[model samples]
Target chain A: MDEFELIRRYFAPLSGAHEDVVLGIGDDCALLAPPAGHELAVTSDTLIAGRHFPEESLPFDIGWKSLAVNLSDLAAMGARARWFTLALALPEADERWLAGFADGLKALADEAEVSLVGGDTTRGPLTITITALGVVPAGCALRRSGARVGDRVCVSGTLGDAALALERWRAGDRDRSDDALDLRARLDRPTPRLALGEALRGLAHAAIDLSDGLAADLSHLLRASGVGAHIYGARLPSSAAFDRLAPAAERTRLQLAGGDDYELCLCIPAARLSEVRRLAQQIGVALTDIGEIQAGSGLSVLGAQCEPLAFTELGYRHFQ
Target chain B: MDEFELIRRYFAPLSGAHEDVVLGIGDDCALLAPPAGHELAVTSDTLIAGRHFPEESLPFDIGWKSLAVNLSDLAAMGARARWFTLALALPEADERWLAGFADGLKALADEAEVSLVGGDTTRGPLTITITALGVVPAGCALRRSGARVGDRVCVSGTLGDAALALERWRAGDRDRSDDALDLRARLDRPTPRLALGEALRGLAHAAIDLSDGLAADLSHLLRASGVGAHIYGARLPSSAAFDRLAPAAERTRLQLAGGDDYELCLCIPAARLSEVRRLAQQIGVALTDIGEIQAGSGLSVLGAQCEPLAFTELGYRHFQ
Candidate 1:
């Protein structure tokens, strides 16, 4: 099928009628009315085949992960997901692949209550780029530069599960244990903490979604806020699977430097710690205290006795 | 350089402080406050190296055209440019190429008064995807489905110059004439008619930007509007270079089916023709009455005697 036919058959139905979306797909541009008294939280992300995921990855998972990553950015900003545009580059228009991909994308979009507003499809190397737009009450967006020296650093959900799954998959460790299967699922489909993020809007001082591991991503938050972080290595949260399967040193490595965890790393004021915990509990997501913002300008992970621990790797970088 | 370093060095400087931009790069998401009472016109476009442009094309031109094509979509919707996000996937981060690309992108962005808000940089095949968001007055977006019978089908500026340039360049015709150089320049930098599109806003019944040739793109507008058009094949505009160098038949072929024109195809009520012409004059963009919307469906290209002409190709289609 040609570009237009592919769009009409596979992509068009993905767009749903929404009150804010004045015009959706099949337009020169999607016309959307931003809710009054709201600021748009916009983020863009691209996933490339073989580079981002396994070459044999299911199209459904690719579609889910593409939009999920961008939504994670919105979540980090404490924005409510509203709309997204997909710019898809594929080697060819494979009907089966497109069908599965659309299904995967629509499933998450439906859950997020976000509409597929507009997009472009072209023929090239398989690359899926999604630009997600969300809305937050004006002046209420959680920024990375908002963290104070005394703020308590926290993260929602488990860390390094997705990266561990990727490592195992790459090593061809086909252990079909429940933990293995769960890790693979985590790698394939990350859950964006939209509800938890929105819940933390007023309470959290600073936030960032973990993509390039806690070390690198949190370092960014620290640099942006001009503060340091003293992370308690033992307090780093992990799934039961992670705890059971990973060796001690490997677990520490993955937890600190393994990337692709879609969990939100946040800094909350000391006074708001209880409120933030209650909120995360109400939202049904695990929130863990990982570190504290400090007055200095570097990151240090503390050992069991509060001594500095040496870290070998920070995180993944695109071009190193 | 790593992804974050590359962004900080090359892309961050592209972002200018704008009143509407609550937060720019360095955050999880860019915070933007859309103008009050204005609806956002959002569009996304992807340019894959060797697919969208010649692999050897200058990074400058690649960047310019990448954002320019997306702006063309916004222009077609009659929106004023505002903010855009760039999602770039490169095999490696070449400093010189990134600098040139940023320069090219900044040149056009500055002219359009749009700000670079945020983006993603990932390791992959060279691919650039931009999601541009513009704004138009509420209830005033020019849409593709608004055409009615008897509306004058108009197009801004010239067509086929870029396509002809590509044809000649592919043939390795190294002609040094001014026309040859102009054609090549056109291919490299097809200007998006933002001013003309904004001028045609309320006066035009329907609009579309020409990317896939006049024949195919206009057919899309026709299909969307549920109307047909009797296009004067000879009236398809051509640059001085095209008139001087292109053979008659080749000219017609290129004008009809040449993709990459970035010009606006508009449907204006016959009564508003004079105003549109005057406005085009004011905007310093050529406006040509190429056809008239008629009852029924499917586009028709007419000869000098008003007889229907047979055109073999419609336009370029990926995976065709």
Candidate 2:
């Protein structure tokens, strides 16, 4: 199969039936109509083979994760994903790979109700670039610069599981235990917290999705909002797999600074904590109160007895 | 510098001062307000290091052409350029390269009035993916499926210069003559026909940008419109450089099938011909009447004496 054939057979069918998508694949450009009173949220993310995922990763996982990461950005902005374009560069037109990729992409796209409207395919080292568009009411979208000094910082879902899985894989611990498989699944197929993010629009003062670990991502939010934060190390949420398999020291390190978790880190008013928790419960995700925004600069972590823990910045940095 | 610093220092300033951009870089997602009564046109294109351009090509050319191709798609749709997102993958953090790339990208973006709303940077083999969004009045966007029998075919600007430049470069004809430099410039900085495309919106029955050569790209428009066309080979536009340097047979071959011209190929009703020509002249582009659309499918090229030319599909195809 060639580029056009691959697109016609695998990608074209992924363009979902959405009323707002006036035109989709096979056109020079995809025409879209954004509803009145709504602004568009746009985000772009690229996942390169070997740099992003393992070189041996399944095509399905790469496809799922590529779109998932972009959607996570929309979730952080309290936006409803509407459409996305995939610019894919591959070494060859492998039919099986394309089939698996399209399947994985369609699975999440169906769940998110987002359409694949347009894309470009070319020959090169494997890379997937997805630009996702979402809609949010004007003046109601969450932003990283809205965190206030008195806001309580919260995160949806558990942290560090993806990082833990990656660590195990890198360490050559390929034992296929149920816990290991579960951890691997978390690393491969992260759930974009769209529902939780949209629900927190009026309740949360600021929001950001955690990709480069909690320490690094939260610091970005703090820097943008010009506020500091302190979290109790003992209060960090951990998955059952993480608690059972990871060492105590590694647990804290991974939770604080290991990357790849697609959870939302948000700053909500203290008075809205119960309501936020209730919404999290309704959404079926753990919304942990991890820290409190402070007036100073930088982040600090407190130990079990409230003594400040030594901090290290170990977030992932590209081209380092 | 790491990815964050690279983005902050080099890429962020490309975010133009556009009111529709409620939020740009430094956020998880860029917030954009599409104007009321207009629909958005979105397109994505990727240019890989060795595949799309010579591996030794300048970073400036790479950046400029990467965005140009995407805007070309919007131009084909007769949309006014607005905002874009870039996904870049680089092997290393090279400040010099980044600076040159940014300068090239900003030049065209500033002229086109398109803002860099958001982007992603990662470590990998050099790849650049850009997704551009534009707006056109609802139900007024030009499409490939609007051609009808007897519609006059027209094309803007010259063709074959870029392909000839590549041919010369590959044959090691690196003469520093003005013609050689001009051909090289065409290869590197093919102009996007934004003004001509926007002007052709109501005048043209169907339109497409000549990227994969007139033969292949026009075939696509014909397939979409379920029509056929016959163009006079002698009427195909050629730059002065091309006419002066290329041999007779090669000239016809290249003009008919060469790619990367970035010119618009439009099918206009015979009644609208003079108006489109006038608009093209106003936009400072050459509008040539090539032929007329036919009732059947596929394209046919007529030689100088009006005899049907034996056509060969030498147009660029990935993974061929």
Candidate 3:
């Protein structure tokens, strides 16, 4: 389908059903009239060619991941997906590639309940930028600065599976050596835990998505909250994907420094840890007690014996 | 300045001194209440290197034009400027370039009263994408589908100057000719005509921006409205820059087929013509009567004596 037809099919229905939305995908502008009790959360991210992903990655994955990453940012703030706009640049518009990309994008966007309100497509080296807007109760969104020294740092779902899967894919293992087909899919389609994030409202003092790996993402929370962290290395969730393929130290490195994991990393106070756990259970996602916020300026990793450990290459830097 | 400092300095107060904006630009997101009585208008556009603009173009100009184009989209729908988010991609984080770009962007944004709410920056070939959000009274947005046969098609401000300026820049005549300076600036920073758009809200039956040139953008409106247009060529607006350089025939070519002028093209009903003219004067932006919606399936251009004129390259093709 051409861009217009594709948009009409997938995006028109999203706005057609929502009372809060005043307009949708057909016109030059999508009109929004958010309900009175809600506040808007907005975030944007861009992924460029020969970076962010493998040089020859499927266009469909690129499309899905582009929107998914931005959605994760909204999730980190405990917001509900509402609308999104896309800016896509490619060498040229190929019908086959566009169809597949649209299909993949629509599948994910439909699942997230995000209306594709507007977008622009043009010619350039393939770059996809998605800006997503979400809604939250007024003055109730979670933020990084709300974390306290006594807060227990927690992560939703498993960590490092995406990174391990990427390692295998980069090495041309394709999830075979470690038999990590599921892990590889997790890496390819790292679902943003939006429901869990929304559920963590009033419980999480600080929240972040593990897009740039847990080590670096945690560092941002600590910096924002003016605290440090002591993460138990053994407490980090690891699957069989790591056991068969990577050495202990290397696995730890992957778990800490690897990127593209869209899981949520949150900080809950000691008094609210049980509530956070119960909420995770309600959402059917695993809640791992990864560490605790400390009154310092850096992060320390604890061994199985409970001794502190150090690391290098904290996480991926886009410029680096 | 670092990102945080830059954000605080440039974007912190975009929510306005008024309370309609429930959230401003400093947090992980910006929140909007939408002023209780208005419908929101949203549009996005992306400018990429070696494609949307010439490679020799200035970064500041790129910033201005990028935001202006999206603003023009809002103007087409007769929407009032409210807020916008910018996404910039550059090869590296150069403080000098950032300063200049932000300065230029803020200049136009402030003039339009379109607040700069939020955005993202990354490492890549320079790309500027902006999503402009504006407000229009409920049931009053001038859309493409509202045009009808016998409607007086009017255009605001001048046309063809930006397109001619682009040709001049492409031919490298921009620097040597002092006369081309204004033309170059037109190409670099076409105004969005927000005041005219706001004034035309009730008078316009249909409207669109002259970004892809008057011919293409109008074609989009006529197509959307399922009508045809009869535009008088002699009645079109031309700049002194065009008269001083290009021949009359070339100027006609520019007016007919060149893109990026960013003027507002609208269709007003025959009955509302006088009222529309009054509103245009009230806004102080010239509103020219250039065409009329006709009950046919194709656009026809009339010369000085009302005879038909022919042209090539009707407008830009997205894939090409």
Candidate 4:
């Protein structure tokens, strides 16, 4: 089938309707009305086959992960996702693959209540680029530069499971234990902390989504805020699966430096800690206070004995 | 350099500050505040190496064309360009290529008054995807499905030069005559008719950008509007360069079916014809009336003597 037919059949149906979407799909452009008093938050992520994902990965998973990563970025800003556009490059039009990809994308999109607006499909190596747009109250959007010296740095949900899962997968460990399966699920279908992000809008001073591991991503917040951080190694949250599979040191390393964890690392004012915890509970997500912002530069990790821990790797470097 | 550093060095500086962009590069997501009572128009385009452009085409040309095509989409929607994001996939980070690409992209973006918001850069086969966001007055944006039966079909600027140039290039014709060089420039840097589009916002009934040639793209407008078109073969605009380089029939074919012209195809009511011309003059762009929308469901082309003209190829097809 031709490109037009391929898009009409596989991608068009995925563009569900929304009131804010004045025009969706099948136009030179999609028209959207950003809600009054709200600002539009936009972020894009591109996932290339064999680079961003395994070549053998299911198309469905690839589609889900592609959009999920963009949503994580929006979630970092405490924005409510409203619309998205997907530009896809495929080596060839495979009907089954397209169907699976559309299904996977639509599922997450529906859950997020975000409409697929306009996009372009072209011929090339398999690559998916998704630009997600969200809305947040004017002046209330979370930013990385808002952290204060006394703010408590926190994270939502467990970390290191995805990295640990990738490690096991690369090592060809076929252990299908419940913990292993859970870790694999975390790696494949990461749930963006959208609700928790929205809840922390007024409570958190600064926030960033964890894509480049806790150490590196948190360092960005600190750098942007012109502050430092002291993360307690003993307080780092890890999935039960990660703890069970990895030795203590490896688990700590993954928690600190492994990537692809779509959790939120936030800095909440010390006075708002209880409120943040209450909101996290209300949103049904775990919130862990792993560290605190301090008056210096760079990040320091304190062990159980309160000694600074040295990490060999900071995070995943895309071009390294 | 790593992806983050590469983006900071090469792409970040291209993100000029704009009043509407509350947050731009380096944020988790760029926050935009569209003008009050204005709707956002969004479009995306992807250009792949070899498929979209010649493998040896200058990086600057590729970058310009990539964003230019997306701007053309916004122009078709009668939107004022505002913001854009670039997702680039490169085989490797070459400084010279990146510099050229950024320069090309920044030139057009600055001319269009659009700021670079946020995007992704990755390691992969060479590919560039640009998502552009524009703004239009509420209830005034042009759409593909608004054409009326009696509306006069019109186009901005000339057509066929790009296609003719591509044909000559493919045939190994490296003619350096003034006309040949002009055609080559047209093919490489076709200007997007943004000002004309804004001027036609309230005057045009329907609009579309000619990326897939006049016949195919106009047919999309016709199909979406549930109408037909009667285009005069002799009235179709062709640059002097195209006329000098192509034979009569081939020239007509290129004018009708050539892709990548990056011009605006619009449908204006018969009564508003003079207004459109006046607006076009004000915008300093040539406006050509080539046909009229009809009540039927297919397109028809009449030769100089009003006799029906038949053509084999309709336009470029990605699958083909």
Candidate 5:
């Protein structure tokens, strides 16, 4: 099919081709008439083969992960996903590859209620960049700088499973028939936590997504909020796969520094802990309190008496 | 400087630091509170090394062209350029490269009245993707399907200059000086014609930017408007470089098919021809009528006796 028709069948239907989007997929540019009295949350992510993912990763997973990662960023801000534009540069226009990729993209867009509005498809190395727009009530979106001292640090969903799955996948373990296979699939294709993020709006004082590992992402929130945090190693949620690798400290390290976690790291007032628990139940995601924002500088992991734990680096640096 | 510090100093200041931007550059997401009664226009473009440009292109030009190309899409839809988010995946965080790149981005952004709202920086291949947001008065944006049969087809500014510059740069043929060299610079850094787009809002029936050559981009408009057109090659506005090229037909071919001309292709009814000319003069740009939409399918190029012209290939195919 031609480019215009492809967008109409897959993208326009997801974007709804409705009044919310004044100009949808078929236009020269997408004219988005965002809902009145709401704020638009914008975020962009670029995924490159051999860099962001395995060079041999399936095209469908690539499409799913690229959009999923960007949606996670919006979720961190407590915004409801609305529309997205994709800029896909492929080495060649392989029909079978595109159909699979589009199927994966449509599946997530349909589930998230985000329309694939307008984008550019060019020839290049396999690269996909998605720009997602979400909406939140005026003056109510979550921010990284709102975390205050004495706030309990909470995270939605488990951590380190995706990283462990990546490690297992790299080791040539193709056992997808078991339960751990589901975890491996989740690593390949993440589910952006939009519902949980929306539910945490009034409950979360500060929020950030764990795309670059918990420690690195949490460091960003702490830095923006001008506070420090003390994470409890005993309380860090970890996958059994990671726990089997080394001692408890190393598993905690993985939970703290593993990239591609895609969980939400939020800070809520200590008094709001019960309410946070209730919201998590309503959203059907486990809420784990792993740390506390403190009136100091830098992040610290503690033993029973709150002494510092040691690690060579805080998290994965992409350059390294 | 680190990525965080660079963003705060260079980008945060450029985002206007206003209340409408609920979240600025430093957060996981940038929250934009769109003003009342206006629709947001969104478009994205990704420029990959050795694909969108030559491998040895300048970083400053890369930065300028990335945003300008997306802004051209906004202009095509008659959207007021508002803000943009950049997703940059680079091999390293070289301070000098970033300083020059940010300078070019800031320069163009300031001139277009577009702010740098938010983005993500990662270590990967040198890939630059920009998602631009614009605003159009409610129900006032020009679209690509508004053209009807018998409408006069017009184009703003001259064509083929960018392609000529790229050819010269590729061949190392730097024979000209002064104005010609400056004209070549225009190819590298295009003026998106935002003001001209806004001026044509009430006059032009349908419009699109001349991105993938005049013929290809106009073909898109024609396909969308469900009409055909006849155009004489001699009526097109061209540069003296066309005269320098051997064989007059070759010149005409390049003038028609050479891409990267960021001029606006506008369709106006016979009644609005004089008004189109007036707006072009007010905007200090040329508007030349070279064709008309007809009740037919497919584009036809007219010769002395309206004979069809043949081409070795159609204008660019992105995934070819």
Candidate 6:
């Protein structure tokens, strides 16, 4: 069978039926009707085999992370996940890998209540491109340009675990301690803060998903909003796994410059902090206050003593 | 500079502002509000370096055709093009290539009246994946499943020129005959039948864009409609260039199985033939009646002498 037929048999079934999806896999284009009065939030992310993840990463993990990162983008915008399309290129047609990949994708998609509407599969180097679509009420989209000076900077869940996991794996640490396993899971299947984002719609002024470390991503938010930020390093939440796995200095570096943590970093007004905290608690996601948006230019990272901290690198650079 | 910085300098300008687009390039996701009472049609197509096109193909043409194929899918659905996102992977950051590629992409996008929304670029083997979004009135979408037996099969413009062009190019024909250049143009920059498709909205029962060769693509339409088709070789439209450059037998073969034509293959009711023809004339697209849909299963190709034509290959198969 050809690659097209393989996709029809294995991957097409993963495009779950939805009322909004008028046409699905069998057509030249998939038809979808976004709910009335809602703006569609669209994002695309491409993951290459060796650069984005280790070449030896499991197919299931790769599939999960590919969708996870795209979903994280939608989550950052406080949009409700709706539909997505995938463009996957592979070296060869392997049935077992395809099945595992589809399973991993479907599991996360089902959790987010999103459906696969369309996709294209081709033969080439292994790469996956996913375009995810979501919906938000018109004019209610949370944007990076809305952060105001004096807003409390917050992040959901812990940081540094995914990068820590990669560091350990690269160092040939095969002992799989509980912390190691936990960190590895974070690297493989980072959770998107969809519910928390949806809950923070009006309360948060601006938000961004942490894909390129807190230092860099927050700087993006600050730049867009034309403000500055003061990040209290001591308050940047790190998982217990991170603390157990690395030294304090290394842990601080990971929290500041590590990538692949798909958590939402938000800027909320000081007046709404109590309500935002209540919403986070109701949603069952940890919301930690890590910094404050300030009136100035550039970002300032503070140590435990409220003194400026210096770092050689702020985030992962793709072409550096 | 990094890949992200490169995108900021080169591609950010290509993202023209559209009022419906609440947010464009520099955000976590692009926000768009589709006109009320319209359903969105989304399609994705990926072009790999050597697999989809020649390894030596101009970066500009690669960018144009990558978007063109996705637009063709939208055209086939009779949807009005709206927005698109690109996920581009490259072997290295070459500024000249990026500028030329952006120029080709922007040229087509301007003609289609679609705005670039969001995208991701990374380092890898060269590949371009484009997801185009369009809008159609609710429940007015043209679909492959709507064809019925006794429907007349029709096509827009010409067929087989692209495949014939590829054959000649492979045979080392470098001297540019008018026919060679015409066929080469057809292969490189085939126009999407957007106007004709939109005009056929209520007139055509079913439709599909020709990407895979006619024989294979027609089979897809038949399978979706639970019917069959008989394509008359004599009626299939061939360009003047195709007739001049290829042998009669070779022309017949290419017409049957050549891919990348990017024309609209549609099914219209026999009773509405005159009205459809008038609409085609008004739209300035040459619509040719090729055959008819039958009540049985499978497809049959008949020659000028009413004899069945046999073929060794059906169309381009990805994994063959």
lDDT of 4 by residue, A67-137 (tens): 99999999999999989999999888889999999988998999999999988888888999999999999
- Give the C-alpha interface root-mean-square deviation per candidate: 0.9, 0.7, 1.7, 0.7, 1.3, 0.5
Residue B111 of model 2: what lDDT? Answer: 87
Q: Tens-digit lDDT track for model 6 on A165-214? A: 88888888876778888999999999999999899998899999999888
Candidate 6 per-residue lDDT, tens place, B1-320, comes to 68668878878877887788888998999999899999999999999887777777777787788889999999999999889999998888998899888988988888888898989999888899999999999988899888999999999999999898888777777758888889888888878888887888988999999987888888888998999889898898989988888886577778877899999999999999999999999988899999999999777888778787664444434312
* Separate clash counts for every candidate: 0, 0, 0, 0, 0, 0
In angstroms, the error of model 1 at A194 is: 0.3
- Here, model 2's chain A TM-score works out at 0.97
lDDT of 4 by residue, B1-320 (tens): 78778888888887887888898899899999988899999999898888888888888888888889999999999999999999999999999999998888888888988899989998888999999999999999999999999999999889899988889899899899999999988888779899988888889999999987898889889999999989998898878777777877587778888888999999999999998898899888989999999998878889889987765454435312
Model 2 lDDT tens row, B46-151: 8888778888888889889999999999999999999999999888899999999999999999989999999899988888999999999999999999999999
What fraction of the reference structure's interface contacts does model 4 contain?
A: 0.93
lDDT of each: 0.89, 0.90, 0.78, 0.89, 0.80, 0.88
TM-score of each: 0.96, 0.97, 0.91, 0.97, 0.91, 0.97
Best by lDDT: 2
List A-chain TM-scores for all predictions: 0.97, 0.97, 0.91, 0.96, 0.92, 0.97
TM-score of 4: 0.97
Error of 4 at A103 (Å): 1.5
Question: Per-residue CA lDDT of candidate 3, range A1-320, in tens?
Answer: 55566556544443436665666766778887765677778887888866677766676776688778889988998999888888887776676777667766777888898877888876777888888889888888888778888789888877778787777777787545435776766766778889998998888898888877888778877887889989998888876656665656577777877887788888998998887788789889898998899898778888889877646443445312
Best by DockQ: 6
- What DockQ results do all the predictions give, each relative to the true complex? 0.86, 0.88, 0.61, 0.90, 0.71, 0.92
Model 6 misplaced regions, further than 4 Å: A313-320, B311-320
Q: Write the per-residue lDDT of candidate 5 for residues B128-214, one digit (tens) a residue.
A: 889999888888888999889989999888887777777767778766766457557667788798988888887788999987788
TM-score result, candidate 1: 0.96
lDDT of 1 by residue, A75-103 (tens): 99999999999999888888999999998
Please provide, for model 5 over A3-109, each residue's C-alpha lDDT reduced to its tens digit, 9 standing for 90 to 100. Answer: 65566654455565455877787666888878888999998877878767887877788878988999999999899999998987777778778877887888898
